[model samples]
Target: MGLLLKEVEVLVVGGGNAGFSAAISAAESGAKRVMLIDACPEHWAGGNSYFTAGAFRTVYHGLDGLLPIVNNVDKAMVKKIDMKAYTADDFTQDIHRICSGRSDPELSQILVHESNAAVKWLAKHGVRFQLPFNRQAYEVDGRFKFWGGLSLKTQDGGKGLIEDLRRAANTLGIHVVFSTAAKRLGVDARIGSVRSVFVQTADGIEQEIRATAVILAAGGFEANSRMRAQYLGPNWDLAKVRGTPYNTGTCLEMAIRDASAKQAGNWSGCHSVAWDAHAPPHEGDRLISNEFTKSGYPLGLMVNTEGDRFVDEGVDLRNYTYAIFGKAILAQPGHTAFQVWDSQMIPWLRDEEYREGRVERIIASSLSGLAQKCAKHGLTNPGKFVETIAEYNEAAVAFQRENPSKKWDPGVRDGLSTQSKTKRLSLAKSNWAVPLIKGPFMAVKVTCGVTFTFGGLAVDPKTAGVISSTSNSVIPGLYCAGEMLGGLFYGNYPGGSGLTSGSVFGRRAGKAAAAASKTWNEDIQLLSRL
Candidate 1:
């Protein structure tokens, strides 16, 4: 028999942003005893939220509305900034368009509508917010122009985000146990309600903790190679994990097996990106967390080992296209691709990712020389690589000559395309097209990094209660949030939307779970009198 621990009013599993959000929200919503557990050690606490850039997409009324919450901007600097209000309609359309209208309509609406309130609530809890100046804005015409519908980020990115959340959780007196893995859910057979959780500590001591309500925000199965191969299909097991190695879908599987949880969303789909080919395979680097991301492909071109351009790199803004491009690269020969850019675009690349010591850079003075250098890396046909660049340059020059009025602008979709009436390349760049005339080109090798799996347990939109697969009804004491609660995203995700979705549903689940705990106490009291 396992050791039985003290009962708690609310129990949260997972220590990422969503778990912290649920734990903190539960404490604030009148839950007296709240406890959180994480499988990872103390140092590996934040799960995937620690590897993000910390950008949050929220609906705001232009610069005026955001000025209050953001900490980086001031009265003087705000004068030169160009920002537009992101409305609910715009947010809704972006999710629908990016997911190809497959996102759950109710979940999408809740995410968009509650985004601002969620951010504000996080701020109230001491999580700092700032404008993502370095990542989201580009200085054009001596003024900072922000695009991609993302304005706020944590001050020091994901590291600071986790630190703030930990501080807030501590302040609320919420107990957190690290290196404790939840083994299974203890369900009451009478009503099929979750009553306790069986967990094992690092020292191999097993214990059962009774709880009034249990919230599962433990995350998806991206880090579990077996689950990835089983659910996400062939070669998915080979994909590098972009986050914590501890999120192996243990809680997700436990809930499904023990409580008959219904699963939903794109099982084969996930959020992936072009990552440094030399990065670690199983986990993210704490010091260089998100910098392993190679998102500057939109400013350049990507070619496979066959030395052929496989994707139209400039199909959309980096925020809109970066996630899916990793899958495109993974599908290429050798599961790798190279992003190439000339001297003109080199200065425009984000320094955190393209800086000299950050990534392995291949440099050469001419296209042939660049291709030859890439051959040493992985390029199989250097001659074809040179020919591809020559054709693209020719089409770019022709399009510019025919349409001289259209100028290349990286801030928006300037429509400096490589397609024209007289001349058209087989794969034309849709925007920010410019001839690579300057010498000294640069390239970087990249592969796929899976962020999180899209498939997860189906839950009620209002309360985030886990829906039973058998009875098709809500489990009395089972709730889910964050990536564990899916159907909000499908094929592709809008940048910064994951964090917002986590916060929104995490808060809802926390509040609802707290209320359920109160009801459980009242019922217990009535049964005692009987």
Candidate 2:
């Protein structure tokens, strides 16, 4: 069965972090009858956020500044930790640096300047950020030090993030319609604005929900195979998806068709990771989606099926470089790569990789034994594998001998050279290239798993209004945010910027829509009649 609301003051599409933020902001801004519509059913309704660690990258003044975000942390305990403050300049520089200065200037600027404010807003609305777990911090001399410009993790990770956002929406009495998919948007030609959307209900009935304004925060088109093949180029459809299957970009398509929107950002660029090769094609099991990611590549060596090393795994931190490596793996012969680690490196693997006993890994006590194990699983013969390891080990030994005093620093590249050795690899391992001489080596196979798409309808930065390509102006009564609003990132992206961007722009778009729709009553009576 379907139910139609005669006239909604605002219609925010999607139900993930962005959509929830938009609805909460609209209702807070005094918009009446604000409703959020999502295509997903209630249980699996947080979109991609449901499967994330909810790491938010922001600017803070060391430990004192971090106190606000990590409210649950005891001040006494925080004082014992050595925290480095990431300045606004540091944040922006990283945004530019990681993407090779290809990210949009204005969007990156806003994200840097307004990131703190956005986090504060989320906190005000009951989003609690807990002290980071094992990933971004390390203890030295009995004092914990934070690294990689990341210090806070959401209290409940992604699920908790969604719950807190939705709880805030409910407290504000924001209406949410689940299991309803937006089919098409109806535009008033005279005003050049979206007035209503035709939605298909859960029971397959068509319903129209007229609204004063529409905020599209329904995420990107990464889930649609044909769209992925068309926009992301050939073989992209073959890559595994790491998040929701519901984000087909239908809202983005409709917005572009009606709003004269220009596409922006690197459409082919995405936040991809080196997920487990044996994992399902899509987000099948929550446990697999959560713990299946094998991110210990920088700590060891990864080789394609040709038994050859390709990328310099230690050029940058895993978070900064992980997004692009998946594409490299996708380009490999079998679209697969193996992350090989020795006994010494095994202790350094991420906690999830160690805790999750389900990972199908090859284990052995010696290089030759490990080679035999890998050969059994189709990574080429044992001889070639051992030869490759010996060469890699020689380079690592030479580098170690040259820099005898150097220590393993995960925060920045230590310039650990794999070039000065007797055998030089074609593609260099610039940093963290130590000898894999320890016994009991282990390896995990990985393939490309895309997180989200980077391209969508371009918008005005200040108002987050969907921009008109023809007039170079905002489309009245139309707004877009979250992953659907592009022009923010390119070439590559910062590790934890997705959720922060979504919240910042989603809140802005919501408040903008509420203020813009204050006088929009022209079609209320007409929409009511229909």
Candidate 1: tens digits of C-alpha lDDT, residues 1-530: 12224689999999888999999989999999999988888888798999999999999889998888778887889999999888999999999999999999999999999999999999999999999888999999889999989889987888889999999988998898888899999999999999999999989988898999999999999999999999888888888999999889888899999999999888888899999999999999999999999999878888888988888888888888888888888888889999999999999999999999999999999999999999999899999988888888888999999999998888898898889987798888888888787889999999999999899999999999999999999999999999999798887999999988889999999999999999889988999999
Report how far off residue 305 is in candidate 1 (Å): 1.1
Which 10 residues in a row give candidate 2 its minimum summed lDDT?
A: 282-291
Clashing pairs in 2: none
TM-score of each: 0.98, 0.95
Top candidate, metric lDDT:
1
What is the alpha-carbon RMSD of candidate 1 to the true structure? Answer: 1.8
Error of 1 at 209 (Å): 1.0
For model 2, how does the per-residue alpha-carbon lDDT over 1-530 read when each residue is reduced to its tens digit?
A: 12346578889999889888888888888898888889988867788887778888888887788686676678578677777898999999999898788878998899898888988899999999976757777665677767788877788678789989988988887788789999888888887777898899889999888888899999898788888889888888888888888888888887777667777888878778888888788563555455666788888999877688888888887778877888889888778988898988888787776444768878899988887788777687567778887898888787777778877765567777688745577777888887898978898888898888999888888878888887878888888888998887785787888889988999999999998777665455568889
